[model samples]
Target: MNQAFRDLFGAKVAGAVASAKALGQVDHSGLKGALREVLVRSLLRPFLPPSIGVGHGIVISAYDDQSTEQDIVIFNRASLPCILIDEESGLFPLESTLFTIEVKSRLNATELEKTHEKAARLEKLRHTPGETTPEHVIPCLFAFETDLVQKTDLHRYQELIGTSDPSIREICVVGQGRWFWTPQGWHHTPPTDTYSEVAGLIDGISSVYERVQATRSRPLLLNYVD
Candidate 1:
């Protein structure tokens, strides 16, 4: 069953990659980035549960603080409705967010630093009128390709994370490898095969969804006070 699942998922990822490469023919960076995001969203939709929603949006805290436009925001649609800002984006409450993803066409040192900065901002967002804030809204980074050498570049990646609280919990450089956070520290796992990378990505997301659902002790709306 697992092998069958991996085979099916790999085919979809391959198609997405081909579409992304085709999009690269366009000279406009903004257009290429937007289309790449669309490709990822479409890739994730069929795999995720219907109760979970996937969209491009900004995450907003109860205090009105907002996260920079996210490439993709995964949220609990079964319990909360995002404020639609447009056809392509919405304003998601921090409490409703399961996670946010930042997609890059190519992973480089500069891009990694930028993703870390965004994750830091996401970690700083606050929820109020409650004893505990939701702990499930993690930040993740994904890239179609990476310019950095995996072994030699590990230090540079670690330096970007520094000694701060980790907000970006999972990262996948498709076909290359992935990095995931644990209580001890960040760990890297090279793909066993091309398809395993996509499997790892999906597994990380599924784990986050389960953790989020497990931690939901009350109505999300109760976190906000007028």
Candidate 2:
């Protein structure tokens, strides 16, 4: 890394450690903003480089009808901005983008259920009437913070992802732990881990960063207006 990058990274680490400590007693709701700052400033920005760099990005804006849930959103310049809806909020808007991400601290039965539900809903919206189908191909990503186990809670999810359409892109599971991913129709299982280990996970599967460059769209409320 260059001197400037090293310096910036050092600063980011310091800020993140401090934020992590300060938010120890706070809830996710209270620390959303600070946590977002940490993810972009510390995790994503520092690791990815310009050549592999996706593109300009932005945080999803709150629509007048719905409450906020997500932390940050990245998109590709040529395509629409990617949307990430909060699992609890169920408030993802219809928009064209290369991909959509569902971030989580860990993966389990409940998490898979929620993800499946959200994916189903988004699929429905894509083919609905009057809804301007996103011009760009859409994909789904799950950023999990745990190692995956086979033939368990994540089995069905794994099956679904493996069988999903090409436009869906490959699913991502990020965490401190590691696991194997055998693409559906394939037999060999490849080892994988967090972005720290798998740098290409984002762009390899879906390049929403491209969409962010072309448009600066934000998530809007379709049904869950509150």
Candidate 3:
């Protein structure tokens, strides 16, 4: 809020971006997965309240449709039940998911298109209306580098991603230094802009899931383990 604090926060975000860049330079695939975990641990998990949780999992609707494994999934386990969970994967209840993120080691058309399709599929899964939770789940795509998209042509990418869907929000090419959102348009920045963008995400998350804890919904369950 204050100028002094703002400057401090900016420095921290800048540090995260710098760290990701260094990690991805050599082992783009392996280390990038590590970077995704880092982003979750630093940018997301800390911000998530106790009632809610963040994980890398797939969403499962009542119809048995399963989603592509997402890099980051913010769900309220305190309120809803998980359809399945094992050592390898977690199949979450669709309505329980509040937000989902797709992570990429680099930004390219192929990756972008795939992410778009995945988000669209998630959008089609209808939620079971019970308690009043956040009506729309925010879908986000974040990358550590860019190979196809140029900083100046963010609008071109936006057109490809489409604007009609409320479930999906925007593509944050943090390593490339730009982001495209249907509502706010494009944000062009330097390659090391990951932290600042993450800060924006925190603000958005706070506003969207602000009321979730007040209406925590729990389902009937039987827990047994060997």
Error of 1 at 158 (Å): 0.3
Q: Compared with the true structure, what per-residue lDDT tens digits does model 1 show for residues 74-96?
A: 88877556788786588888777
RMSD of each: 2.5, 8.5, 4.7
Q: In angstroms, how far off is 41's CA in candidate 1?
A: 1.2
Looking at candidate 3, the ten consecutive residues that score lowest on lDDT are 217-226
Candidate 2, 117-193: lDDT as tens digits: 55454444332233333343243444433445554323555665665643233344443322223345412223332
Superior by lDDT: candidate 1 or candidate 2: 1
Against the reference, the lDDT scores of all candidates come to 0.77, 0.39, 0.63
* Model 3 spans > 4 angstroms off: 28-31, 83-89, 129-134, 148-154, 161-167, 175-195, 211-226
Most accurate candidate by TM-score = 1
- What's the C-alpha lDDT at position 134 in model 3? 34
Residue-level lDDT tens digits of model 3 in 59-97: 866555668888787887665666446532477776677
What's model 1's overall lDDT?
Answer: 0.77
Q: Write down the TM-score for model 2.
A: 0.46
Report lDDT (Cα) of residue 95, candidate 3.
Answer: 61
User: Residue 81: error of model 2 in Å?
Assistant: 9.3
